[model samples]
Target chain A: MEFSSKLLENAVNEMSQLPGIGKRTALRLVLHMLRQPATQTNALSQALMQMRTGIKFCKSCHNISDVDVCEICANPNRDESVICVVEDIRDVMAIENTSSFKGLYHVLGGKISPIDGIGPHDLNIVSLVEKVKLGGVKEIIFALSSTMEGDTTNFYIFKQIQDFDVATSTIARGISVGDELEYTDEITLGRSILNRVPFESSLKL
Target chain B: MEFSSKLLENAVNEMSQLPGIGKRTALRLVLHMLRQPATQTNALSQALMQMRTGIKFCKSCHNISDVDVCEICANPNRDESVICVVEDIRDVMAIENTSSFKGLYHVLGGKISPIDGIGPHDLNIVSLVEKVKLGGVKEIIFALSSTMEGDTTNFYIFKQIQDFDVATSTIARGISVGDELEYTDEITLGRSILNRVPFESSLKL
Candidate 1:
C-alpha cells in the first residue's frame, strides 16, 4: 500500500514488527499517534530511548530496574526466604499487581527451548541454584509457562537444586495451555501463582 | 497502576489520548515498543516528528501532501472533471487503493457531526463547492460514510451545488451501516464507488 509519507511508512514498519501488530493495525496505530500533540509523540520517543538506556536487569532478580537491585528484591518487608522464579520482567509486574505475593523474585531471563537453542546454561539457572545453595532461602517457586520449554526448564531447575534443603514448587498449570501465557489476564496469572504445587514429588517420574 | 518509570508513564499517557486506545492498551503498546531495536524505535519517533512537520493538506483536494497538492490531485491522468468527495484523506486512500478510479478527490477533513460541533463550515466543503463552481467538473461523488453525520454532510453538499448542472451522486449503501466506511475494504469500497446512485430529487425538502 502507498503510504502518506516516509515518516508514516517508517512508523508503521516499526509498529508492524511488534508481536500482535499487522501492517493494517500498525497503520491505524501510527495514524492515531500522529493525531496526538507533538509533546506526546516526543514523550513516547524519549521514553523508548530512555527505557533502553536507563533500565538494566537487576543484578539480584534480573527484573528491569534502574538500580542494582529491583524494587521487589530490595524491599525489606518482602519475604527474602521465598523466591518466586519467572521468565521475564513482565511476569514480575503481573505478580506485583496482585498485591498478594509477599516474596522476592528471580527472573530466569528465558525458558529452555531446544528448538530455539536456549538451554539450561543459557538461562540464569546456575545463579538460582547458587542462591538456594547459599542456604537461607526456604522456598523456590517456578512461575514458568506450561509449554514444553517451560516444563524442561522446570525439570532442569528441580534436578539442579534437588540436593539443597529449599522447598521447590511450580505455579499451578490448569489455567494455562500451549503458548497462551501472553494472553492470560493478571487475575488468572495471580490465581495460578497462589495455587502453586510442590514440583519435586509431582514430576518424580 | 504504578508504572516502572516516568518515561513509561509519559508514553502511556500520550498513547491513551488517542481515539480508541485505553490506558491498558497504551501500556501494552509502550512495553511492546520497548522490546524493539533502537533503530526501529528511532524510525518510529522520526516518522511521528516528520508527519507533524512535513505533511500539509492539499490546497485543492485537502488530501495530506508534502507539496501544495497531493500526488493524486497533481497527477495528469486522473479525471479532473470528476471529483470524489470523501470524509478524510484515509477515504481517499481507500479509493486510490482500488486502482480502478481515475478521478481526483476532495477530502472533507471530517464528516458533519452537529453533536461534535462539526458543520459544513468546519469541513473543506466551501472549497469543494468553489472547485465545482469553477466549471469543468462533470460529477461530484459523495463517498462519505453511511452515518447520520455523513447523510447530513451529503445533504448539505447537495444543497450547495443544486443550482449547478453538475451531476451529484452518493456511493452505494449496500455494504455498510452507520459510520462503517472506515472499516470497508478496498474492493467493497471500489464496488460502492462504481455503483453510486444519483441523489433522489424528491428528498430536496
Candidate 2:
C-alpha cells in the first residue's frame, strides 16, 4: 500500500516484520498509535527495547528470564527432582497457567525438526543431558507437542540419558477436557484407548 | 496469565494495548520476538518511537506529512479549485491509489462520534471551513465513510459551506465492483438504483 508519508511507511514496514502481522494490519496499528498520546507509543517502544536488551535466560532450564535462573528453577516449593521438558517458554507459560504441574521445566527452545535444519545440537539438549547426569533428578517428563519433531527430540534425549539412573516418561495424549468423543480425531481416539488408565486411577480428586 | 518474568509480562502488556491485539496474541508476538535476533526488536522499537516523535501533519489539509505542507497540497499540477474532504490520511491514500480524482484533500482527522466523545470541535473542521472561505474553490467532494457519524460530520460541514459559491457533492454510495447483486443488502441495492449513472457514463473506457 502507498503511504502518504515515509515515516508512516517506515513504521508500518517495521510493524509488519512481526510474525502474523501483515501490511494492512500494521498500518491500522500504526494509525491507532498515531491517534493515541505520544507517551503511549513511547511507552510501548521503550518496553519492547528494554525487554529485548535486558531479558535473560535461565542457566539451568534455558527459559526466558530476568535473572541468571528462572523463577521456576529458583522456587524451592517446586519439585526440583522432576523436570518437564518442552519446546519453548510459551509451553512453560501454558503449563504454569494450568497449575496442575509443580515440577521444574527444561525449555529445549525448539524441537528437532530436520526439515527446518534444527538438529539436537541446535536445542538445549546437551545441557539437559548434563542436568540429568548430575544424578539428583528422579524423573524427566517429555511434555513436548505430539508431532514427529517432538517424538524425535524425545527419543534423542532418551537415548542420551538411558545409561543414567533416571526415570523418563512423556505426557499422556488424549481428548481434551470438555471435548466430545465423536468430535475427536481417530489417531487421538485410538491413542487415548491404547493408553487407557485403570477406572480407580482415573477417579482423581 | 501468570508470566514467568516481569520483563516478559511488561512487554506482553504493552504489546496487547495495540488495537485488535489480545493477551494471547500479544504473548505469541512477544515470544516470536524473543526467538528472533535482538537487532530486529531494537529496530522495531526505534522505528515506532521515531515515527511517533518525528511525524508531522500538513498545515493546510491536516494529513500526515514529513513537511509543513503535504506533497499533494503543494503540487501546482493538482486541481487547487477542487478539494476532496476525507476523515483521515488513510482516506487520502486510498483516493490517491485510485488515480481518479486529481483534486487536493482536506483531512478532518476523524468523524463526529458522540459516543467516542469526538465532536466537530475536536476535529479539523474549522480549518477546512476557513480554507473554503479563503479559496477560489469551485467544488468540494465529500469522501467520508457512509456511517452515521460520517453523515453527521458531512452535514455539519455542509451547513458551514452552504452559503459559499463552491458546489458541494459526496462520493456515490452503491454496490461495489465485482459484487453480486443478489448477495448485496437492500439498502445499498436501492441506493445503487436511485443513484444510477447515465448509460453513456457507465460505458466509459
Best by DockQ: 2
Off by over 4 Å in 1: A173-205, B175-205
lDDT of 1 at A112: 90
Candidates in order have lDDT scores of 0.77, 0.92
In terms of lDDT, the poorest run of 10 residues in model 2 chain B is: B196-205
**lDDT (Cα, tens digit) per residue for candidate 2, span B148-188:** 99999999999999999989999999999899999999999
lDDT of 2 at A60: 89
Name the regions of candidate 2 deviating beyond 4 angstroms: none
Per residue, candidate 1 scores C-alpha lDDT tens digits across B107-148 of 887888878888778888888888878999999999988778
Model 1 lDDT per residue over A146-201, tens place: 77788888898999998889899877655544648778877777877887668875
Model 2: docking quality category: high
Candidate 1, CAPRI quality class derived from DockQ: acceptable
